[model samples]
Target: MSGEVADPKPGKAQRRRLSRSLVIIALSIIAGYLIIQFVGQIDWGQVYRSFGHVSWWQVLILVGVLVLRQTLNAVPLATFVPGLGLNHSLQNDVAANVAGTVTPPPGDVVVRIAMFNSWNVNPVDGMAGVTMNMLNFYAVRLLAPVVGLVLFTVAGLERHRVGWALLCALGAVVLMLILAMVLRAEDWADRLGRGAALQAQRFKASADPDKWSAAVNKFREQMSDGFTQRSTISMLALLAMVAVDSMILLLALRFVGVPASALSIVLVIGTFFSAYPLTAMPLFGFGVLDAVLTAAFVEESGLHYEPIIIAGLAIWRAITILGPLLAGAVTILVWRRRSGSNLNLWGSKDTAPTLSEA
Candidate 1:
């Protein structure tokens, strides 16, 4: 026993759990306080009245736009897996959207990967496709702010907000530069992975540098292959999807009697581009997203119809978040019944079907 190290204490694990619980409680309290404040400021009667202004035909159009957006979303996946049908792709997208509502960054990707595995798709190819799609998605979002900045300058309005647009443009450029380095610079991805692993180790996480490096290199290679194979079509589809989705939001505002103008359109797109990162939050960023969008509507668009803005936001959330969540749940249930597989969406034993079964 001379050189034996002392066993780790059970109390340390319990203490870590307690610390996590306390942090969660503190965050919950803060969020609850904010929500109470937001609710107190709103007039429910006006919000209800605003909803009556939106016509049933307009609601149909909004639903159609959302359907089209979802359809376009599956294009990149179909490109990645040539044999995959559009219906399956749509189901996967819905499943991803559902998972993303509950989890943070890359939750959609996690669900997609699991779905791909069940469908007998190669994991590397699946990851490559998802990464390429996400890259294009964010690229378009970042670029939109720049376009809005140009539009604003041409319109001779909101010159003061140019700095914010420029900042977002710079962020986009930085992201592109990092992507280029990962794909084109030999060993750069590996080095970045090793550095990340080193940082993780400092936080008491177990990470093998060599393994991380290898994975990064593989990811880069797959990305390179995907780009070479389907970049043009995928990028086009992604751009179109973003544009249509933004239009959906604009239409929502219009339905609620928010007068549409060139400046308003530019502001709407720009505001969405800026607040896009909020989607990484839980429940598809429910309260946080509404607050950000409401602020943007008032400040960016100079709209003072607080009730209309709140109502429009509710419609937007219904179309984008709640609808997909419901559809995804149905899809999962159908898959379970048909496959008779004991699949778990959350972390548990994976019941992904094999190639033969799929």
Candidate 2:
């Protein structure tokens, strides 16, 4: 009777909170960028030319690498929790997880939860595991920009745009704050959803409040246990994902007939930090991606973006927006036929068994 509520309809305030988060990120990046462009003596030609390249094969490889990056995410995700009735096959989860990663609203979260739910796991408990996994993910991601910031400064990348370095640092700090919230989530979830709290502790007997309290303690303990067990694997998987992400852009660079050095790949991916550029969120890295990637590489590596920018950005858009959308559509059709009905979100079954003697 204790679990996080499975996808409670967001209240108006929750929607506002989500929107505000996006706005803050967007404005900070945009405003900072404009200042650098105008006040900071940025090379407007470099900014403009970064997008005009053409290399179809390299672009194809780039798309493949992006898809591969998403696939790598599945490794840690599936490995994160143990003994949950994971409904889908490992292949399916990886494909869906990849598709999920290309778009967001935490639709990635939805895909993962559904995979578990299909196995008869309670939705709420699955939700908590998924939530915790994301908390871990964001915590890891915070490293991207922080590392970028320090590297950029030491390596003189900041000479091109102090604003860019600052934005990366800001994102890292925000992610750190989110990580803290995730660590102490149950304490906060207690306030957000009494219903969620009940579902989180689905192992206790008697359906009593006291039982729920005790089970909540156990739930947190189990979560910590899972983290400790998988920390090494999780960290490795994440690093692999990041590597795959960098390679995708490298693929794009190749497509544009440009050969990027090891260090250049590091900076472009760092500035363009997120994997989900196709999300509906306004700040979801849409207008900024092509520009910053081209500019950053040019600034650091003395590369020309004219041909690279056009071809590379085109391929990125195709895979991120079209590829995943098509895959998800296929998943929907197959899942419907199999389940004999449309299953929108996934979850696990949660039922309290009679208290077993300790």
Candidate 3:
């Protein structure tokens, strides 16, 4: 044998990690390319000039609004997670927001479970809370377009968009009905779960229908009480967050010198709400949504306003992305100090139970 033994073949977990890394790298390259293309099409000089119009006081006001928005965002999670105070929920929400922004899927999930573990929360309960928050959030997002369409009609802007909004409303209704069925009856939950597993099996051969059925039943049981009692509060909190988000975008547009004569507030709100669903996409629909919004504003307000539209969008994006990142850093540090322990971001010894364990 050679003096240096050949490196042992990578294990299954190592292979999985390598595969995920490759996928992330590929996605990053694609997103970067799209960003470059988007930037190339915009008039940066005009956008910069538009940005100069924003005063220091206006920036301060925007920051204040952003803080409130972040606070409201933590409410739903706190409402759902029994014994998790607003302060801890804020920490958890902020940290997970940061992780979700920088990494994909399980990144946020890991941060959430780890934080719950540090706080001595039951793992199953934490997961159930997180799941409810997501479901409620998405349900509200789907309904947003309907609200927008109503506003559009009220403003007498246009009626041609009605068809699309109707489709979105229908989807929301279907989603709500299915969720209600799952929560109201264990049999329905089991059937739904097994059906989902069968569909999943198309992609992953190892998907077990019986396990999925058991998991869904457990999830329904875990969530029913909180969903019945606290769901209204959760929904309201999310709606308030959406309202604040829209307000920030509107303020950015005005501060950047986009006049109402060019684009009315009603139109702005309608378009922004309609586009809100795009946030479900990767990186919160970074390049794609930005481009879409800019194009919509330009089409409505004329191409002359494109530069200011881009500038306004830039401000909104920066606050929403950066505010959470900075806050999350502080929250993570506080969590470390309060817990008096270094928690492993990836499943620590004290980490709460995972879905499989549940």
Candidate 4:
């Protein structure tokens, strides 16, 4: 009887792990499918034909600009996270952002992993904290564009999609705002979760985390003053970071053979991210970004749907998705070498000894 019981336990554990893995794989596959379908819809032959039409120098400039946009992508994350002082170098962190953007699952995963390696600090609340940050991000994003779109609609600029645009932007803004409130309302979230868990505990009689909760409260209190003290700094940094993202959109379009109109590109990005959140997938990013830009530009700017902008969007997507992965791999590779021995993932001299010593 004991042997049979033990066998089922192992079997059940294996099944649980398998199920989790399958779920992750399924989500990844779906993301990949959407990306492919979107990009495949683009006429690659047309893109290549347009590619041949552009001057070599213009092409090179576009590529270089794209790289800069990728490199700068991390500024907003650094601004919003609200830890670490102004003295920190932004270089490698930029690379980390590039990696996260390059990798799947909101690109923040890559950023977080690289952060763990570099800083050795395991963030509490994990994805919940990230979701909180996203709340701040899209809340600002949805509003700015929304104001612009509403004005445009009121002015009777758009022929159609005005209601759709307003509804999409408004809905996204509301969603992001709710998430932000939920995230910032940390006590409320925890209390609700704790209540549910406690109810379950009555059925199963679980170990209490009251002590841990106490410790967390203490830590939060300790941090709150510092956060408040630097709230202005943090918020300004955040604003700049968002500006960087907006600028990147403009720059990427310039590189991609799209017209370099700031207002137009911003509106396009505003519309897409406002409406479609899931388009930020790794495999699907290039295609989705293309659609976003295409939707915005073709409608607003009266630009023809030549595939160069699509290619540029592809390049922009590459910077965010593939660039950081490549950078992280390279950093790891170099860390495995003798000369880079003193550096740690956190970039502290004390923790990582030289590879030669190892």
Better of 2 and 4 by lDDT: 2
lDDT of 2 by residue, 84-141 (tens): 5233433345445553544334445555455555555554555555555565565556
Tens-digit lDDT string for candidate 4 (87-187): 22243354445444333333334444444435433344222234434544454444444544554565555534555556647865677444334335568
TM-score of 2: 0.58
lDDT leader? 3
TM-score of each: 0.76, 0.58, 0.85, 0.56
lDDT at residue 329 of model 4 (Cα atoms) = 64
Best by TM-score: 3
The order of the candidates by TM-score, greatest first, is 3, 1, 2, 4
Better structure of 2 and 3 per TM-score: 3
lDDT of 3 by residue, 200-238 (tens): 999999999999999999989877774656878987888
Superposition TM-score, candidate 3 onto the true structure: 0.85
Using lDDT, rank the candidates from best to worst.
Answer: 3, 1, 2, 4
Q: After superposition, how far is residue 140 of candidate 1 from its true place, in Å?
A: 3.3
